[model samples]
Target: MKRKWKFFIGGLVVVAALGYLGYQGFIASAAYQYELGEYLAQPGIDASQNVQVAGQVATGSIEQKSFDLKFTMTDGVNNMVVVYQGTVPDSFRAGGEVVVAGRRDPASGVFEATQVMPKCASKYVAE
Candidate 1:
């Protein structure tokens, strides 16, 4: 009886330890959300921070070279160039609201986007 209790308690401890580690990992890896203006205004952001910057894609700022996508995101006041290395979504276009997720390139002063999520403005049409 005592041996069975010992085994059960050990299993619970292992499970709890795994759960704690998983939670910590998730928190560390989660993307920090910021507006384009706020992100650029920061004196210096943590280089290791995984960030999601939300803004409107500036007009006439998109340039496509093969699968590479480069565009400027603006908060109607401040702007920053975002360089993404993948095909953008079908909803992606100039003047569209988008959230780019990635870390800033300390060398080039550009946000290196890993993902571009376009928030379509006209998806809902009231019938």
Candidate 2:
């Protein structure tokens, strides 16, 4: 009886280990990070799929409205237009570094940003 119990416990451990490995593999295949240039270069990236794009806001390209905003993002060469319909981040500004999370609109050639994060300015640090 003791031997049977030990074998059962070992089997349970092995099953748990396999389950963990499968979970890790699934997560590894799900998401990834890429800069704006690399993301654009990838062929057949589904425009409807959510993604994060990092780049600097183009200088003199930010247009603000009462409840909407339009801006251009650039990784020095490639540029992507971003449209956001929500409140802008505190660090948002022209020529500032930012990461926009959203899906691309293939027809309009714009990224509809659902979330935006701005890189803090180096020159202005809190004391």
Candidate 3:
């Protein structure tokens, strides 16, 4: 009976540890999506937390230096500069819509993008 009780307690401890890890993972991976205007309206956005912002690429704002890219995204009312170091998507271009995931710098206000997802123009058009 003592051996059974020890085994049960060990199993419970393992389950509790797994649950705690899962919760932490979920919290770390979860990111909130925002439009450009909505993101700009937030006065106290946490710079350490990852966030996603969607907007149209500003015309004449794309500049690339090898794998590094710099561009401006706008929501007609506000604009934000985005800097990313990665392969540019084939569909990305000026005037196209994009969603960028990363943290915004508190000092410079530039968005340091970890990922860029270009929205296909054709797929979003009304038939």
Superposition-based RMSD of candidate 3 using all C-alpha atoms, in angstroms: 2.1
Provide TM-scores for the models: 0.82, 0.70, 0.92
Q: Highest lDDT: give the candidate number.
A: 3
Clashing pairs for predicted structure model 1, backbone only: none
Among all candidates shown, the one with the greatest TM-score: 3
Candidate 3 lDDT over 1-127, as tens digits, reads 9999999999999999999999999998888999999999996888988899999999999999999999999998899999999999999999999999999998999999999999987656568
* lDDT of the candidates, in the order given: 0.92, 0.86, 0.95
**Deviation from native of the Cα of residue 11 in model 1, angstroms:** 1.2
Q: Residue by residue across 1-127, what tens digits does model 1's lDDT show?
A: 9999999999999999999999999987899899988998885888788899999999999999999999999999998999999877899999999999999988888999999999868667889
- The residue pairs found clashing in candidate 3 are none
Rank list by TM-score: 3, 1, 2
Task: For model 1, state the Cα shift of residue 46 in Å.
Answer: 1.6
Global fold similarity of model 2 (TM-score): 0.70
- In model 2, pairs of residues that clash are none
lDDT at position 50, candidate 2: 71
Cα misplacement distance, residue 22 of candidate 3 (Å): 1.0
